[model samples]
Target: MGSYDAFCKLYSKGLLFTKPIPLKDGSHSMRNIIDQLKDSLSRALTIFYPLTGHLVTKKGDDAPSYHVILDCTDAPGAQFAHAVVDAQVADIIAPDDVPPIVESFFPFVGTVNNDGHTLPLLAVQVTELVDGIFVGCSINHVVADGNSFWHFFNTWSEISRTTFRNNSNSEFVPRPPIVKRWFLNGQGPIINLPFTHHDEFIERYLPSPQRERFFHFSPESVACLKEKANAECNTSKISSFQALAAVVWRSITRARQLADEQITHCWLPVDNRLRLDPPLTADYFGNCIQALNATTTAGELLSNNLGWSASLLHQAVAGHTDASIRAWLEAWVRTPFVYQYGQFVDHQSVMFGSSPRFDMYGNDFGWGRPLASRSGNGNKFDGKVTLYPGREGGGSIDLEVCLPHQPMKALELDPEFMIAASPSQAF
Candidate 1:
């Protein structure tokens, strides 16, 4: 394994901890909360076990370990705490709208910034509102997935709520810590899995710059839209997600026609955490396993009805013979031929992330549940949509489109492209 590969192996096996300031029962103090976290945090680490590789370090800690960002952003009405919460997260701070906190979360592929440290491994920030507080974070991709992070957060919340006295067994036990050792001799690209037709893959999804922007289906809108599409397709199993994906695929193709490009790569993340036998714990730390480069022709993707499309995606997932895809990915990282973008294409580049099931609105980190909560906004994306389950069976999705401001203006004008369900209908 190259140093970078070995580094990744050591790296992906990390975890993140989050604390939502709970509804203060009128007597708890910040010092009291910190004191409790200090005692219970490490113990909670045990529940997250082996995958919790190393406790993150600050700027000059005496350890042979690396550091990550713990960025914190402020809410519209949040009271800023200089040492704990800042007006913006650490990455995006500039002449550009990108906040410093967003910039801090970029991966450390070996670029130094003004801070002297690699880009943040942990991003810590807060969303302040009259109701309660929201703490936002960005753990390194190498270390944990959203499930694992939420698992840890739930445990921390449990401990904090009970003042470190709640001792119920969590859903999963931790694994053994990964020991880092040299395995390769060279560097550059270190993963190699066959995606038989890479450009063909790209052409299907990322065809044009116009399609490479963001689009969202509000939770309220998505639920109703899915129902309408299901009735049109005559299939009850057609979930909002499947329907949205189909529309996104179609819209992207339309965008490509306008832009006159044929990029075709749509990289969708497959959550393989539960794909394992005896489903992994929500806190099963480390990079569990993810499948990327799922591709299909635009014509094929858009022509299908909701049921057909959902079934198609289901089939692709079922056919993945590499049940041990995670191990395969880790082992593949040892080679240098896997990360190549041979004969790059400009089709459609779409990334999809399922929303995390964190009960964010209910998170009361001792100050009472937040009146409202939201994600930090320093990050940006093009042609990507993140899905989160909402108040009921419904859900919220965050979209980051890279279209020029003018297209965005056009999108707003076209009500059919984006619409929301009534509040009564929305969960």
Candidate 2:
């Protein structure tokens, strides 16, 4: 097996990390919080493996792993002495502006913080306080999925709690690396495409029109939506994942209709950890297994009932013996086809549901659980959906909608699209 250092290049290539805040209050100390996070990260750093990458722009590879820096926003700091300031700065206290880590990995990479998804990926701003602390980090998806990242974060919290007293056991035993069962020639998924004469597939996937963001729902609200959906579809038992899938599928379809588009597509990233015998440990890094796919056309999708639509989605992703999904993902990841074909998907959305509930509630970093948790907006996908465990026993889903301003307005008018909480408008 290749050494952990072999995986460092891959880990650095894949963006995997998150911005977490303790609370929204303004009394927390940035130094203490950073120290805790630094310790937590250091304990888990070995598991993350060698941080490898070369900055081709300057022809140098020596640099510290990404650091936390504070960017000044209009939000207030400390006492309520200043004017009604509302700017927010990064929780990380850095001396000055730093180039993005991604830039070092991929030359000619775009740089700018615009929409919700891309914003976090580029740079995160933190607001420090006693009631709560804000963190901003753009975690790339190539290294570890939500599961891997959570596994490490939880360990950090667990160890941090007792570190002051004694060296807690934050054992990060290296998990067996994913076997290179496929040919070394395999290029991975194909994501690049040529649209029209000038537009590229990647651009279409990350449309400039839609602003990416994570929208969260309370446990009660999620249960209510799922209950209503279940009642509507009596034959088959549906999950909150399916319910949200139905809603988003329906919503996207409706948006397409208003936009005067008929043909559409959607992709779901399938996890193949369990599909393998002696399933990959929670620590397994790199791309394990995935399947990128499209649903029925918009015309048919819109005409069908929610239950029917959900059933179709369920059927598309069900069943697995060996890496059936992995085989598909390998084909895409190994090739440049995804880059070419994605442009043809006039209306496409990527959705993930049924995420582990343990990721959120269990991630207590000393100051109790986070008051709120939401999904990160990514510029790579048009629409993104993530589901977390609700308070009761069901599931809650966060959705980020990206579309033209007119379609967004129409979405607001619909009864199903309830405004949960506004980012800029509400505190």
Candidate 3:
């Protein structure tokens, strides 16, 4: 794994994806659905065998200079659970804030936050609702990114629907994931055997209190923002993502009222699987994302218009190239104990993640399409904003934001922020 990727291993926040699976009949009881899911996942383990494996770390110093390897010897099968909530499907999709009820729908591994490197790196929980079933997954971030994680999810759904409809008990083929590390150092997911520096990075930082809120940006509003941003710069055109992120970043900075001299950053994770010199294939899994950032003083971000923020985002994104990615990899190998940049990024840094590219709306598993989707509780961090395709499915964007309570309230009254936003009611 890349040193930067190893940092993720220190924390065990996995992606949780939930979609309402339609109930066929009374025969499709929670027990029956759970059984089918268990069987399908058991079969899936043969293909995604690595997930059945666990992460093992050798004793090391204070930071992430230790040897952390995947131990596949013990086959602790992925977790499977079933729960019945009083809420109904309609109640879940109601035009309101993401119900706090869905928080209990998540199924974590070992414990909610376990530092132990035991086996069974993956787990699933089938949350049963009044009229529908919630299929939720919690896979370790070290094992996958948005691309690989969704690949595993869709593949599991395919196998699930195939068996549910055909009821065939025969061997099935699942699209297997490639385990090779890309642009990483070492052999077999190991290099520097001492992670003391990473340990310090974790201990050095104190987490600030945060509150999460959901916001909506219709397709028309997104287009308007893009149009305005494009109007700002003739040489550099910002993408829709740039425009949206710029707006949110600026809005949050203004709400917080950081000092003019204070430096704030927006951590934007770039998917490098397709941006490499030769480029990685679609199936190449593991953490292939590198966080690129835009740095601006509080005064500049608060003083500028949305388009100005978009231009800064565009430049930050434009800074990444094939050579730069390769250079970053080379530099990482030369300096294993320290990360050259992104060290100061903390609660003050609002990171933008997820995109329409994930196609959450396209995931279908024998049932009708999902009415909505959301990231697991793991994503709730101060100054974090996630952009997902709207549940309406015509390319509108939904923003899931987490901030301080004061900042969130400030955002509610922020005219510039509210002019283009509505309440997004998907969890």
Q: Pick the candidate with the highest lDDT.
A: 3
TM-scores, in order shown?
Answer: 0.57, 0.61, 0.86
Model 3, TM vs. native: 0.86
The residue-by-residue lDDT of candidate 2 on 342-426, one tens digit each, is 4333445545532634455555555555534433333333444445453233454444455555555655555554543222211
> Distance from true position, residue 47, model 1, in Å?
4.1
Candidate 1: tens digits of C-alpha lDDT, residues 1-427: 1111112211111111233345466234445555554455555555544333322223333332232322223111111121243432211211112223332222332221111123433333433323223344444444455555555555555655555334343433333323232122332222332333223122112223332222434576777767866786666766666566655544545554433334344545566556655455444455554545545666665555544555554445555443555455456554323221222223255555534345544444444433222232211234444443442334764343444344445544444455541222111
lDDT leaderboard ranking: 3, 2, 1
At residue 9, give the lDDT of candidate 1. Answer: 11
Output the number of the TM-score-best candidate: 3
Q: How accurate is candidate 3 locally (lDDT)?
A: 0.69
Query: Ten-residue segment with the worst summed lDDT in candidate 1?
Result: 5-14
Q: Write the per-residue lDDT of candidate 3 for residues 1-427, one digit (tens) a residue.
A: 3453433322122222343444677435556667777888887778788778776766555554566666778767687777778778766666344566766777652232123265356767777766767777777766677777777777777787777778776565545688766544333444664344335433222346666567888888888888888887754478988988988888888888788988899989788877776788878877677778898898988887788888888888888988888788776666655342246346466887766666666666655567677556654567867767887766688887887789889988888899989665544
Who is ahead in lDDT, 2 or 3?
3
